[model samples]
Target: MEEPGKIKLTIPCRLDHVHLAGHAIKGVLAETIKDSELVFLIELAVCEAVSNSMQHAHGCNADCNVEVSIFLCNSELVIEVTDTGAPFNADLLKNKQCHDPEDATCEKAAEGGRGIFLICRAMDEVKYKSFADRNILTMRKTIKPTDRDGEP
Candidate 1:
């Protein structure tokens, strides 16, 4: 069983393991959150975070580890994705615009670079930091009272 208000999942830095993180988030939140859409959004944000950490940070090396810690506090759900690989420039997050899949004229149109944009759109608040040798991406979402089946 998971702890009362938090759950942490550590997975190898590989693309195949990304889905595990997503499923774990959905399973934990689905128990108390009745809204499927909200749960899906959270899951998507987390999966993108994990994928970015694995591909960009760890370079898809399975020898590394990515830790995802999720906390349910009062009316908010906070998720932190931590990795010991290369640190990123958090400032880039400020410039990400939501990528419209249908915009053919967009100069930046590509298969990548949309992770940060999607994450920002899904969560209420997003933060990124690097200290010492670790990089952590923290995302927060406010859960309205009606979204939960019971008090968090």
Candidate 2:
């Protein structure tokens, strides 16, 4: 049974399956957030998290599974992505190397860390930890009164 104000989903570790989670996130956030871009960014952050779990943590292993939990409390939205494959390096959160997309000097070889960087940029808070065999990545965003009330 799901808790009130929360939605949870489990998906096989596959890049193709990531979109289902994204759609679910968008559906939930779109209800109160009138901003389509904000909704999209949240969805994108989730998709990246799921994709990283499938590709990095699970090594694209179809046998593993990823769990996503979303919670809406007061004006905050919290999301957690969990996997059992491998623990995430929490240190990366402190040293995310973000590049300016418009900078022509940025090297394409910097492909390794953009996912976590984007996730951090999109959410107000992002955290990762592992205990026993479970690794959980939690993300949070606070919706302003104007955002929820659709006030200009």
Candidate 3:
């Protein structure tokens, strides 16, 4: 549930576009938010998600686009990223396991493919959907007044 004065921002999916998204999130938090910790958390989460799209979703192709939307509603902040890249096997993520420290797989040792894991850990809710050639990821974080009061 968003409060009465909810904020919404939408940006196109270009590598250059993330700067706009990041700026929007920071601007809103600075202008209206009173809690520093919560503001930082939301901003970081947005960065990770957008970075995933900018870096991985296009596989280095500069022509592809990724759409981003952010909204602050009553007690929740919602962010969505959508891309038209080839459909990915979401199950690959669901079944992923941490590699053994002694015998890490070559793929696991690589710098890619960790975004989903980070998103899962950092956000309260994560969902993926594919429709009409687009991959949509939605993430939410619950904001409590106590979260601002320094209560764990």
Return the top candidate by lDDT.
1
The sequence of per-residue lDDT tens digits that candidate 2 reaches over residues 29-113 is: 8778887888888998999999999998999899999999999887899999999987777888886556435555445545466
Task: Report lDDT per candidate.
Answer: 0.90, 0.88, 0.68
What are the models' TM-scores? 0.89, 0.89, 0.69
Off by over 4 Å in 3: 1-17, 92-112, 148-152
Checking candidate 3 for backbone clashes, the offending pairs are 1-74, 2-73, 2-74, 3-74, 13-66
Q: How does candidate 2 score on lDDT? A: 0.88
Q: Which pairs of residues collide in candidate 1?
A: none
lDDT tens digits by residue: candidate 3, 8-112: 554455656767777777777565466776677667767777767667667645666667676776567777878777666677446435322347777658666
Top TM-score: which candidate number?
2
Ranking 1 against 2 by TM-score, winner: 2
Clashes of each: 0, 0, 5
